[model samples]
Target: MRASLSIVSLLAGAVAAAPAPKIPFVTATDVIPAPAVNARQSASQACFVIGSETLPKEVSDVAAALASSVTCDKSATTIANVPDVTSGSTTFSSIDFSQSSQTALQFALSKFATANPLADTDLQTFQDMLDVYQATEAGIRSVGGSLAIKVPKFFLEMQVSRIQTAQGNPPTAAGLQVDHLRDKVLKNAPRESKDLLDQVTQLATVLS
Candidate 1:
């Protein structure tokens, strides 16, 4: 009887020690979260910049133009409890945004990729989030080819700079204009740049 009790105790201990089931990813559909911005507006403007078949090789100058055009503006929306975004076992909060642009972007992508064979969750939302990821990756890769990568690449650096300055760590806010805010803000951006614009917009919700 003592041996049986000891075996039961061991099983009970093992059960107690097991890790809790991980939370599933959150979806835009499930909870849009608060502080959502006019990402589509930025996206539209970016698409115009991307319309040229061959982007100019001058990365810094062109990127400055691209970044300048995508001034994120806040839109009024009903505030909902900010849902903690997760993908598979990875929570959105777990991803690092403080690294180099490439490293940070890749890290974010990897977290989402690992979520494949996704747990029982809405696939559409995951795919949409993934599109946003790929868009940033595409824009980064496009630097040498077509898309002028430095633009998205700068977002990472900008976040770092923000951390150093006052915006804190995150790339979404249009930042205070010590002088005056620039015009040509995102309003009717094309579909192509939507994903990248979205990634930037999403960062503001959590990091800002």
Candidate 2:
């Protein structure tokens, strides 16, 4: 009788120690979508009217002209609550502008190469542009911290310079303006470049 009692006690203890089954809660499917800039508006803003087939050897000029035309209007929405978006296991507070810029530059370079395949001179220009890009990236990385603003200005100026070089002319006054901004940002970054890029990328995503 004592052995049976002991066995009953052990079974009761084991049952008490067992974890309860998990219960799942149902969620509504009507999740709010992220704010976005209309594709038509974004494309219109980025559109360029070029006459030549080649990636205007003067890439800087082309880029500057393109930049000048961009107007962040009503259709251009910021991707607010971007922290809600997750990448793998992590949720980002802002967009990665530098990475996006790098991507854009690479795409631009590739497009330019495709457009100017027959122009042997443009090949050297492309090489020089890549060199400048490498130096600029290295410069920003070495400086660190708020010194990152230099990246955008440098990128903008490089875009202008490339177009100018392609057109057989030196970078214009506007390119110099971007260069000045770059110098100031490099000397005193008001905010970290990485942070700035994050914000910019988040905003740009609305364009997508």
Candidate 3:
């Protein structure tokens, strides 16, 4: 217990005062490689602070002291009702689920060109979307069944719209890093996922 407390005290100063992903978009593995499949899962399921990788070495050390008892969430239906951030729409009612999530996201981002960085209210809006993404990721993973793979598309689709949103305000260093991580996921996204994300007819702004 004393050892754990000491690690916590150390991290209080090690972690940055600014927002997360401050390191230009490197995932947890980049901060420090996971030892094995189960070890990686343990780190993944640990508390957010331990898993955040915001402080890299400091966080990795802290994670070693804690045991991950939490299980990965596999509830694929959890994201079904969440409103689309782009246009505030919901189009996932069909059986075939044919529409692609990557398509919606790409379309939205295409409208982006970097104007001004997000500010004040714009930051809040960005944070709201981020909260949803983080929450969804906590439970969803590549190891899950087919349903789990399909569930995250909605959130993925909204990101392109965010690029539209951020671009209108213009892309900041922070925003660009966010985009980088989003693309990494999209590129590595698991297969067999059905139709995901809401439909958008207009530009990203059309929905935002």
Best by lDDT: 2
Candidate 2 RMSD to the real structure = 22.1
Model 1 score (lDDT): 0.35
Per-residue CA lDDT of candidate 2, range 23-73, in tens?
976579666678875433332233231122222224433333333332222
Overall lDDT per candidate, in order of appearance = 0.35, 0.37, 0.36
lDDT of 1 at 193: 56
* Cα misplacement distance, residue 208 of candidate 3 (Å): 20
After superposition, candidate 1 runs with Cα above 4 Å error: 1-110, 113-119, 145-208
If ranked by lDDT, best first, what sequence of candidates would result? 2, 3, 1
Comparing candidate 1 with candidate 2, which one achieves the higher lDDT? 2
User: Regarding TM-score, does 1 or 2 come out ahead?
Assistant: 2
Show the colliding residue pairs in model 3: 97-195, 115-170, 116-169, 116-170
Off by over 4 Å in 3: 1-77, 80-104, 107-121, 142-186, 189-208
Instruction: In angstroms, give how far residue 206 of model 3 lies from its true place.
Output: 20
Poorest 10 consecutive residues by lDDT, candidate 3: 83-92
Which ten residues in a row are the worst by lDDT in model 2? Answer: 78-87
lDDT of 1 by residue, 1-208 (tens): 9999999999999999999999999876796658743433333244222322333344323333344322211231111211223233433223423333543334443443312222333344443343332233323333334332223234433333323233332234454221111111122223325564565444433322
TM-scores, each model vs. reference: 0.21, 0.24, 0.28
Candidate 1 accuracy as TM-score: 0.21
For all candidates, the clash counts are 7, 15, 4
